[model samples]
Target: MNKAENIIVGISIGDLNGIGGEIVLKTFEDERILDFCTPVIFASIKSMSFLKTHFKSTINFHSINSINQVASGKVNVFNCWKEPVNIDFGKEDTKIGEFAIKSLASVTKALKNGDVDVLVTAPINKHNIQSEEFNFPGHTDYLAQELEGESLMFMVTDTLRVGLLTDHVPVKDISKHITSELIEKKINTVYNSLLKDFKIGRPKIAVLGINPHTGDSGVIGTEDDDVLRPTLKKIKDTGKLVYGPYAADSFFGSNNYKNFDAIIASYHDQGLIPFKTLSFGQGVNYTAGLNKVRTSPDHGTAYEIAGKGEADENSFKEALYTAIQIFKNRCDYEEITSNQLKKAPRIERKQRPN
Candidate 1:
């Protein structure tokens, strides 16, 4: 095929020892998904075949040597490597981490070169993925350096969306990192993401406080009152519907999160804990505010359930749907903006002057 009729979803198999294989194969096992998007898993055919059998999936893979052979309505597995590799289920190995990096790099290259429309990555063992060439804390950090635009780690489900002010940062340093500039950047990123990716108009964003109960008016800590409050106020003054400095503790418990289009958290656990509790397998970790579209399952590599059929493929499936939808939305936005520019209003001259 000269061009793909449907969007091409690039799959990067994360940690071989993790449940990445199970979830990836299980998601494609259902033939119905091929109707809208063509899935191209960036791994060897041998590895995919093994996973299909290991997970007992009935998926039939169309092995392709390159991206040009990727046809719609069938699952395609690009041969990233030909040689047989070791696969020990539930065992963490740095060697396995190397393969994860290989798959990620290959798929990311395909996305950057415009071969693939969007990327859906499986979970990786972040600790083992660190090396000389790839020292990223996670996929979001790595992608920010590789792709254009400011990246925000946006975790989303149908009803709820959470973006982090600080991701993959240590708890002790999170306070120092939540500066006015950082808070404003993350909030704007989330705001723009809701408009562009999620297709929401006039997005109302709420930001969680840095300290507990918003520092209880400087009793617990002053970062929330001093830093977060001022930054959010500054952003709100710009005519955006951004809110909060909300008490992270009671916001979700009281269901106050339902009032906003999106929520920005001070750090990782503060946002993800509530999000995962509410959505978990039903959610997708989307890297928003980027030139290229990328998403992943909200959960991490479940080493305990690696290669087991017990692993749920819901999150991975959701990630796939989210990526395809966002890609289309971005294209629509571009076309709409372009047409508006071309159809700009012109000033009419008076007939008397003529």
Candidate 2:
């Protein structure tokens, strides 16, 4: 598909009562997003009306019933829910949880059906949305199941990209999940994605150790020595520029992260703490290893300042830009790979004999 032929981005409105709707309306206020792609939000008409009234944004919203109704150069919205419900700005309700899940499901289906090119999600409240119906931990797991792929969550800024081995796990249980196979898989996924999606050829990756001082050669812990070390060796054997099990505490301080295209952490906080510290309000959470592109602002729903017109739209804006860039990069990478494969046999014959 041509770049200007209108790329459709399916957006899942996070929590109806939180800043999701506000940011959705605020981010689209710029005509730039429409310049790159057509953004279609799966939300309620009532929710959009509430955000326009609350945020005082002058952006126009065109609600449609189906994906085919989407129009280029305008903000198209798919009304997942039509009924009006009382919104307690900054408060959580079970009804809002249901609405958020419904939006997610609709967008996910659209993406799977090739109706949309990418999916950009707003932040959802995990605590308030925990129930049998919404059984997954968060969007990552939900998307993993729906897309039927092994997904890795990565936080990205312009300079650094960090991926977690275990996201949303208890601090104590993190070590249990850090197996050699899992680490190898995460590394391969990160490596392939960098080459395919980000267009980074021969990308260098840093792997963070689970313990302090990289186990200090077993002085602090054994997992870094036993688990991470072997995994790094296996990845390196494949002729990939992968390094480390670097001491988690000192990796960020020594500017070691700058040496690599991305860092793989043992757990969520290990990676996120440093990433957020570096790009808190500007970071984008990108789901790597999926067939379709998906991203969200790294920050969560800030209910404390909801409806106050105090929310920062920088992260959301970055998320939108990142998605578009990755989509373009993927197209370029595919073209390059396809051409190389077509010429491979000729190059092989030239090397085979005199």
Q: Measured by TM-score, how close is model 2 to the native structure?
A: 0.95
lDDT of each: 0.89, 0.87
RMSD of each: 2.8, 3.0
Question: In model 1, which residue pairs have backbone atoms overlapping below 3 Å?
Answer: none
Q: How many backbone clashes does candidate 1 have?
A: 0
Global local distance difference test of model 1: 0.89
lDDT of 2 by residue, 1-354 (tens): 334356788999988778888888889998877887899999877778778887898888888998899999999889998888677889988788888899999999999998888899999998777788779889999999889557999899889999988898999898899888899889888998899878887899998889988888888889988888988998899899988878888789889899999999989989999999988989999999988889999888899988788888889989988988888888888777789899887634446664
Name model 1 segments beyond 4 Å from true.
Answer: 1-5, 346-354
